[model samples]
Target: MSEIPANTRPLEGPAPRLKAPAGATDCHIHLYLPGYEAQPGGPKIPELATVEDYRKLQQWLSLERVVVTQPNAYQRDNRALLAALEQLGPDTARGVAAVTPDTPDRDLQAWHDRGIRGARIMNLPGGAVTHADMLAVEKRIRPLGWHLMVQFNGCQLNDYIDNLQRLESEYIIDHIGKFMPPVPADDARVDDILRLLDRGNAWFKICAGYEASLTSAPEYADVGAIARRVIAHAPERIIWGTNWPHVGVSRDNYPSDADQLDVLLDWATPEQQQKILVDNPARLYGF
Candidate 1:
């Protein structure tokens, strides 16, 4: 009954119907603490969602681990993300950072020591890094055992699959590869995604169905089909997330964290759910 925190959105509802396994991880979230202004070209969202706010969400989801992604709004600045990780504790939280080509290796090393396991390429609009920076970042973070996490228009994934395969470090494609307009279940792009997984070079984060869904909220049947395809192909390689704060997405369409977790029950079996929600992230993020 205490006053709700300022500058943050509330959880959609109560805890989910599906009980999460112990050590489950929400692998893709962002932190926007107060006073951290967005850079000139970064993605914009109103207000800030702090680590403290997200912990309430974790408790609601019955999740113990998290991966706080560096949002495009912060561009190459990782100070806010690092602070969130510090608060979440190294054992229960990991992070994916956004860094520019000019960022020093020492800085990257420092981020690694702080529990960042991946370097993110926000390939969408307002992103600071680009495709050109992928190989360079791979070269830099490979020594530290970090992979490259990428978010972009899913239509273009095939164009970069070969490039992604060649990188020495492992990689991840965000949001079911986030195919815009929601490609057909049999679309060649889906095949390409399967191929990328088969090649054993990359992983997929099954988050943000609304980002690519042509259908309405709660079900997102179109994107759900894509998620099933990816999970059917390799449950061991798939991870789940809330895409918390749901930036750029309208509130009316934004799903509750519980609803987001419930959708998985419709996609994968209980065992597969454990792998996606708990086991896979354990291997990928070292939880």
Candidate 2:
């Protein structure tokens, strides 16, 4: 048999000391395949991050399920996300795709049938759908029972607070609110996140701290403070992810996924760990 090609960017490393519970899900990850051109106005495509590569990380983390998030690099072109769902299998994987308010009903139904459970609204540069599209897109996906996975500069979360409050479908705020430069645990903006969580439809994903943390890693103390508070506020609504093939960072500076998981798990109680790792995602993504 031909040897399986390892990822050009290695995914295997030290296993996380916190063994993932059965049904534990990586609630966010992006998978890249060859032949998909990076669209204009989007971020440059990272190295090919295939299903095979992610499988290694899954084994290393002892995870059972995954949610493939639509990378901003592809914009609204969901061909890559669709292809990944096929490779990962519907039984163990789900997807969050990029779709506009104008996406046809037939296409939405088609994606749902294939195990796509949510729509992504990345409000940063290169995101195809932004906060402006939130309610309209919600109108389109609400009937389908799909949720929204949202990401933006958490520092400006208040700028979009009204719209976030207005969203009818369940929505997720990605990357521990992704507060650029990171905020104090007691900041009023953290209160904004907590308020949204109280609304019950809003959820928080704890991942990719490096994207917004100024404190650097091994202990992203700044991001950890915020993550702990968010988890404490709504452990039932919290979920975890690897953000694998972590883009932008050079390979030498790449975080060990094991260590990242440890850092977040450290912030949670053993019971909260079970909910964050397994229960919450199963409820949110319908796994």
Candidate 3:
């Protein structure tokens, strides 16, 4: 494997003060290898983020399990995701790939056999599947016992409420609803998120706070407040992630992985942290 570029990650940081519980899972991440080229209609390929580099991250954070989601850079091509799963090993890793309604059942079965447990629907600019195709794609993956990883502007939760209510397969809203220019915890949009969670099939992933936070740094106060509220409302339904390699961030603004994990200290209690880090993902992803 090629050397991971020095600028790609903060690989030399002190280990997180809050160690992850055993069987702890980082429920959202993306791994990139050299051979996969960026497809059209998505963001440009980021620096190579290899499984080798990620294993070091796992060690630093004390994370034993992972859920590697397909990055928009690769669009609907799942070869990179499959390759990462193979490298990370099925015992400790699972994958969420992008698939369309037309994806072959044979291929779906093949991916399932390789430790894939979910389908990703990133309904943003570079996303392969949108809200319009969500039900169709869900129909195709539902039989495989796959859940959906849906990411879009959480600010529009009200607009998408009907489709969310209609989802039959269990689904997770990525990045704490990914409310671009995130709203306050009391925002009506957050209430919409709470309503969906109350519906019993929806989950909330609290990660990537920098994606939507206007607030800066070690605290990310705005995002934390919202995360705290969500965790308080339904601790059982929450999961956490590092959003590792943080492709969208500039090198100068790259976040500390240890800090990312430690933020849970502020947002959740020890017991709730246990659930967010281990129990919740184990149940949701069949770890």
Candidate 4:
């Protein structure tokens, strides 16, 4: 085990000036417990985030649905993530789990029955899955009606475009594929993302703007432009999330839950906002 941050900040902040529509969902977030060890050779996301702590955030943001992603901190150890889904209740909360290609069929079915709608493969540095395992993992989850939620660098997506198109399961590209240095609006990466959305089997999470932006938080202007382009390309495929507890984020730069939600107003129209925050997530997560 490694040292985890205290995360003393209250989950309180200014209310988003734009209220989230009914059934609005935070499609990406995590739960962390102290003293838990990361998988060997995996990225460290040591932090103390709990479901109860996140309830305060849910109230602050007025979001009714959530999807708890199994974090790299507890790679392949989904006990905490499963507990969170139970605590949040299956009716309003769903989960995206981390599993190896070898994870048993029985276990996968159990997780699916308990409200896990997706399996995530973090291809970023220190992520659990390798490039070679992407399709194998997708094959494992396909039978369960779960999509593959992939997190990777935008610049690298083109490399896997052929594999992505061939996967039998529907897929979600996390954080607009987390484009680095926030590329130009017309960058080829943007077109690749658009092409993925055009396939009708893919979805995008319009979360974690700060991670992809060269600009700092509260504004995140450059990443916001890319997100806007994604929305313009396909509002129906875009869903919103706060990336709460902001694991691995420096506390000084970690944003308020409300501030993160407010950024969406700039990204979409009120009707588009409704689709991103509510309807789209409902369809994706089965809320």
Candidate 5:
């Protein structure tokens, strides 16, 4: 196994169960890249989710492709995530990087070579991310044909939908709009998600983000609703994942890798299920 920063690392509990169908991909997952110190006010290293742990988890899930997301902990130093892509190799996996406006073209090209199709601008901690920040990053990444993968919560994407949609780059939503089911369609924020889909290039990940609060087997209401709503908006763009190791976040029901896959099966029909689990990601990530 490769050495990660000591402070941020995986707490391996059990060997994971992959059990996914052939050509399946987990649209979302994180690689803990600790040890890289951050400048003041920059992103902090949350917890490390090792690639080696995920590789075994992928085998357990029966998946061949994965999208490695750089977490808040590593800040903007994506070398760790890039290294994880290198570990994943050329044929099987790809990544979505977390980069700032200042990331060099060489570095971006380097990531492209390592199977990165996009750059991420995580905005999960409320209004901390500004549109100006996104606009600046847009200028940096769109020219490369890379998409923008965003992680945010609160008010759906309605607040930023127009700006997000108008951009030329493809927009991939994180965690089913972070909608909590049984919450009112008005407050449910499904409209905001639907609006992004109306733009055509926008996509969504039917993932187990901690905010969704999933129960292992028999399913959880939040994630199932998220999947249903996303598929309703754009089944072709919807995808599934475990968000492995859970990160700085925790879950209500800690599902094993298999437990997570079952969430998708429960939410969509067999064919749509294949789109969420296998086909959609292959098209989006070119897997």
Candidate 6:
């Protein structure tokens, strides 16, 4: 393939034969096709990938199951994502989808049966979900027992935290609340974010090596500290993901997947690691 010397590539390997609790899951990964149902007047994703690509990645990474998510490439037609879900087989995969404001109940039900468990709200990517649209979207999905997954910088989340929670639904925070250090939990600025977590309807994923550690260090203890605190509060609510393909990502100055796993295993006990690396995602995604 084309070599850019800068694209973040996934590491290939098998699980070190350390007995992970049965049924572990990889909570995040992306797949793409050249055109994800592109349409006139619709926004097209600049980056794209495919399912055939994902199969190779799964084998290389030794992940038992995957939570396939929409990567903003599909505009709003999730056909490509849903097709990938259909082919992944129920026992090995599940997904979160990007749905339109007017998606119907019957269609959502069909997706649920096919193993899609959540929806993604990408705040960082300039898309807007208005207050009315938020309620409508929640209304459509409420009966499915799925949460609204949000991916945004912690700063932006802090701005709209209250309104986000008002959707009257559970929510997932991507990448350790994107925690920025030096902001005390006591500050009023974060009170809205605090209330969401306190209500027991919020969860977070510990991914993003670069985002957590600004310097691209593989031994990202400081970055993991943010995750550890969240786990301490509610281990069951915390989850983990590989962010595979690392697409458009830069390699760490010193790179190693074993190093990343080492930090994760060191951060949590064997059982907790299973929950983080395995059990929780199964329950949440129905994998």
lDDT of 1 at 182: 85
Candidate 3 per-residue lDDT over residues 1-287, each given as its tens digit = 33434335666578788988899899989888877787788887657888988998888888899999999888998999999999999899999999898999999999999999998888788888778889999999989889999998988777778888899999999898888887889999888888889999999998889888899878999988899999999999999999998998888888998988999999999999999999999999888
Clashing pairs in 4: none
TM-score of candidate 3 against the unseen true structure: 0.96
TM-score, every prediction: 0.95, 0.96, 0.96, 0.94, 0.83, 0.80
Spell out the clash pairs found in candidate 6: 32-49, 32-50, 33-49
Cα lDDT tens digits, model 5, 152-190, are: 663455677667867777878877666543344344467
| lDDT (Cα, tens digit) per residue for candidate 4, span 95-172 | 998877899999999999899998888877766665578888888888888988888888777787888889777888
Which residue pairs collide, candidate 2? none
**Candidate 1 minimal-lDDT segment of 10 residues:** 1-10
Between 2 and 5, whose lDDT is larger? 2
Tens digits of per-residue lDDT, candidate 1, 130-212, equal 88888887888888899888888888876777777788777888888888978877899889888888878689988988778
Question: In what order do the candidates fall by TM-score, top score first?
Answer: 3, 2, 1, 4, 5, 6
Residue 225 C-alpha lDDT in model 6 = 59
At residue 124, give the lDDT of candidate 1.
78
- Stretches of candidate 6 off by over 4 Å are 1-20, 34-48, 126-132, 180-195, 250-261
**lDDT measured at residue 15 in model 6 versus the true structure, 0 to 100:** 53
Q: Where does candidate 4 have its weakest 10-residue lDDT segment?
A: 38-47
For residue 281, what is the lDDT in candidate 1?
Answer: 90
* Total backbone clashes of candidate 3, pairs 3 or more residues apart or in separate chains: 0
Give the clashing residue pairs of candidate 1, or none. Answer: none
Q: Each candidate's root-mean-square deviation in Å?
A: 3.1, 3.0, 2.0, 1.7, 4.0, 4.3
lDDT of 1 at 206: 86
> Candidate 6 lDDT (Cα, whole model)?
0.65
Candidate 3 segments whose C-alpha is farther than 4 A from its true place: 1-7
